[model samples]
Target chain A: MATTETVAGAAGEASQKGMPQLNFATWPNQIFWLVVALVIIYIVLTKIAMPRIAAVLAERKGTIGNDLAAAEELKSKAKAAEKAYNAALEQARADATKIIAATKAAIQKDLDVAMAAADVQISAKAAESEKRIAEIRAGAVAAVSEVARDTAGALVEALGGHADASAIEAAVSERLKG
Target chain B: MTVADQGLVIDPMHQFQIVPLFGGDTLTWYTPTNQTLWLGIAVAVISLLMIVGSSSKAVIPGRTQSISELLYTFIHNMVEEVTGHEGAKFFPYLMVLFTFIVTSNLLGLIPGAFAPTSHIAVTAVLALMVFLTVTLVGFYNKGIGFLGMFWVSSAPLALRPILALIEIISYFVRPLSHSIRLGGNIMAGHAVMKVFAGFAGVMGIASIVPIAAIAAIYGLELLVAVVQAYVFTILTCVYLRDAVGEAHH
Candidate 1:
């Protein structure tokens, strides 16, 4: 306690106030304190608080570096992802256009095929109708020739009995009625 | 209550009082009981750091445990600055020294805790150790002829003795200077803080000035604590150069 001084006590005191400048420390006592402080400080730093601080700082540094590296990786991945998305979009666009072209070709091909079939069927039906009309016309001409031949035969017979033109016309009319 | 009221005046500086362990040298150096207590506390704390750090020697550090490596690197870099390429070799010892001083200074700044460095004896011992080690290193590296450092090669032959003596005295004074710089600085800072605190107490309403001063001083003290540690380490580096450096080169 000789080494320790109370500032307030020493200052307030009248006679002893001047004694504050004096040092009463012994050599051995100073050495003892020296050794104790050194050894203790050495041991504590070597053992406890320093380790805590060291551990904390190292961890922080490592984590920060790791985070930075991870971020870099993520950025590359994102860029790659964007590129892939763009590529896929491009592929989709091309495929859509190609399909449209194919579809158009297919539709055009079908239309051409349908038109060819319809043309063939329509021509075939028209040819059959023309043949039918020619047969009916031939039959009508043959009927008129037959009627004229019969009328001439009746006129020649009527002339041998009375030679009357009126009788021939009446016979023809009667024949036509029967 | 005055001294008369309590029957005894309480010494505010009781914490710093030196109490003799025995009538004579107590285990080599004069030391008080409180100092012994502080030493034990310091040792315990430092030991705990070692245990925590060496717990797992993982390549990739995890948790707060990795701080051990950063401290290692910090001191390693400091040593390299002082010693160049050779500095890496002294990494462990340098790290140990830096961490110990830095932590001790920081611990002292804590309330009610004694800053061992504030005591001249403690700082003296550290400085002395540094001095002895650097000198031994010089001698070991350069042999007996390293004493030639005291004589500047360019000096005239007649002036050698005086120059040598001056150099020797300065050399002897290294530890004193090294110790005093740290101890004196810490003591004055603490004293100023105490004085400001007293002023604040005396003038309650206008105490903001002292409070502001205290705050500023506290910040400065923290900075000083770091700087002092660095200064001490740097000094060790400079001394080592003297120990191992070529005089002519």
Candidate 2:
């Protein structure tokens, strides 16, 4: 307690210590060291720190710019490839249409030739049948004339009066005509 | 222990005391004091963040690297925007200023730590450096025509002289306000925290209120620390416009 009281008394007595900031006694020391510290900081900054940071920043910017440019190039290349693909697809479609039209025309030509040959064969067979029919009619006329003559002669003989073949033939012929 | 045992003998200003680090009652200009130690700490912290943090030249940034880049770009854009294209040249110097001030300000926030930025000696040096650079650059770039910034041709003929006087006065006051603004804000916040801590020392169980106030004020001081640095940097850029950019009334 005595020691504490004495220390407090000493502090109270020297309470005139005033503002230490106004004490010009230490200003020189403070200024000296401050200038030294500043010079050191300035040297470190200008010589080392500032340049390194700037280089890093600039390098980053360059890398980013290069990456962006490369991306843009790839994008354009992809667009060109897509365009070529579409053009090829369109060309293939046109070729298919042309091939289909050519095939249809070829099929039509073959069908036309087959139908014309069939029509010629059918007309020739009809002509031959007509000729055969004509011949049969002629043969039938001859046979009928002969039968009439025979029957007429037979009748004459039965009636005790004979007749010639020419007369029978003439009469049969006249009746057939009628 | 002696001061603590006294309980209510709260000397808030005692925190700003710059005693010699080694055994001595005298402080020469070269004396390594607490101010020197903290200034060195600020420089080390800045070097750690900027130099070591950016050692990895990753195409993709990691945590510390990204933080370094964030500060770099923030100040970079600020300089470009405020001072136009030509101001880009001073980016490294401005980065130094910003990093130094902010680091000093924040390091001072530690319990029982000395704040170099809170001292007028340090902030005044920084502000004057900016002021000198701007003045020298203005004269170098524009010659005597740089004085046209004070002429204020945009004003009417009768008011031109009056506007010029005001411009000149405000122009000269830049360093004063710049230094004081940062030093004052930091000193005030830290001092206020100390005062509340003194209350906490005396008020027994009710010390919680003062403790809470200190906590809240510490948070404010943290904001103030970064904000004052930002203010200092941006003001540097704004003043730099007079040198590098075309004269605008």
Candidate 3:
């Protein structure tokens, strides 16, 4: 420690100008140079740096704002497009429903017409068959009566009596009536 | 009376010496000295950061550009915070002061480089400039009402005159404290480093301790350099509030 102090003291004495900072001789030179340095710095900054940086910052803010606005616009456009699509889809679905209902009604109408025609044709055929059956029954009855009359005549003739067709017919009718 | 004779080589104050750069016995005001060289270096560094670094004008700044921008925003905010919106006009001046001080302080940390900020003459000029500018701005903005800063209206009328006297003295002392604080901090750190380095030279194997201290103190000094610049600028802003801002006192 003593050696350190002595050396520092000795070095200080050798320099002979105690605390060179307080020395007034160099103050002018330092102040002049300091002024020059500051002026140069000031000019460089004001002229070149500040404006450029400020412009860049302002431009960035503008770009960000513009991009945000653009994004918002696009989003609204997409929403509008989606809404249009939905509306179209709804319209198509309603049209489809209407078409199906109309087709069903038309088909039902055609089916009703065809069924009525078929029913008329079936009823007409049934009525005509019934009339033909009645007619055949009447003819069968006449044939039977004719057979009986002939048989009665043969029997009378075989018994060696007069063969009377009118009387036989009248008696057979009376027996058939009973 | 030499370090060789004293068996220790510590000349802590020698670093503050303003010697001529060219071979000369006399130093004129315009004569370029080591002080001039370092000041020029400080200016170049400032230009590089402010001009070349930002030449890209990139919206998304590159590394150097970001650094310059960061410094810009930092100082800008400081001015705005202290001086309010009206003080924005002084932003360029404060930026110059900040960049110059911080650059020179950092440069001074180089083993043999002279730090202009370590000199009272340099810091006094800076503080005086701030003082004068603040005075000019105060008068310009408020006219005669600028003197209202010294008047303590909040105090009782009987005590106001005394308080005014105190305010006036403190206001004048601002430049002194402002310049000394920066110069003193820088000068002390550099001198301490030199003292430790001188110990390292004489301590043989034990010199590792002083060498280690120098390393540690170097880091502290780096912080000091930046902090002092900040302090100087912030104080400037605070003083500026009297000029540009409404007299809230």
| Strongest candidate by TM-score | 3
Model 3, runs deviating above 4 Å: A1-18, A121-178, B1-6, B204-208
Candidate 1 lDDT for residue A99: 100
Question: Model 2: which residue pairs collide?
Answer: none
Candidate 2, B1-249: lDDT as tens digits: 026664666667778777667745555677778888898888889999988778998999999999889888899999999989999999998999999989989999999789999989889999999999999999999999999999999889999989999999999999999999999999889888888887787888999999999999999899999999999999999999999899888
**Deviation in angstroms for A111 in model 3?**
3.3
Name the top lDDT candidate.
Answer: 3
Interface RMSD of each: 7.8, 7.6, 8.4
What are the per-residue Cα lDDT tens digits for candidate 1 across A59-82? 767988999999999999999999
- How high is the TM-score of chain A in each model? 0.57, 0.58, 0.61
lDDT string for model 3 (B1-249, tens) is 136764876768877877778855566677788899999999999998888777998878899888888899999999988889998999999999999999999999998999999999999999999999989989998999999988999999999999999999999999999999999999999999999988888789998999999999999999999999999999999989889888898
Q: Which scores greater on TM-score, model 1 or model 2?
A: 2
- Give the number of colliding residue pairs in candidate 2: 0
lDDT of 1 by residue, B48-123 (tens): 5555665665546665345655566677677777766654555455666676677777877777776666777667
lDDT of 2 by residue, A42-115 (tens): 99988988889999999999999999999999999999999999999999999999999999999999989998
| Candidate 1 runs further than 4 Å off | A1-25, A29-126, A143-178, B1-15, B20-32, B53-70, B142-173, B200-208, B241-249
How far is A161's C-alpha from truth in model 2 (Å)?
Answer: 23
From the highest TM-score down, the ranking of the candidates is 3, 2, 1
lDDT winner, 2 or 3? 3
Instruction: List candidate 2 segments past 4 Å from native.
Output: A1-17, A114-178, B1-7
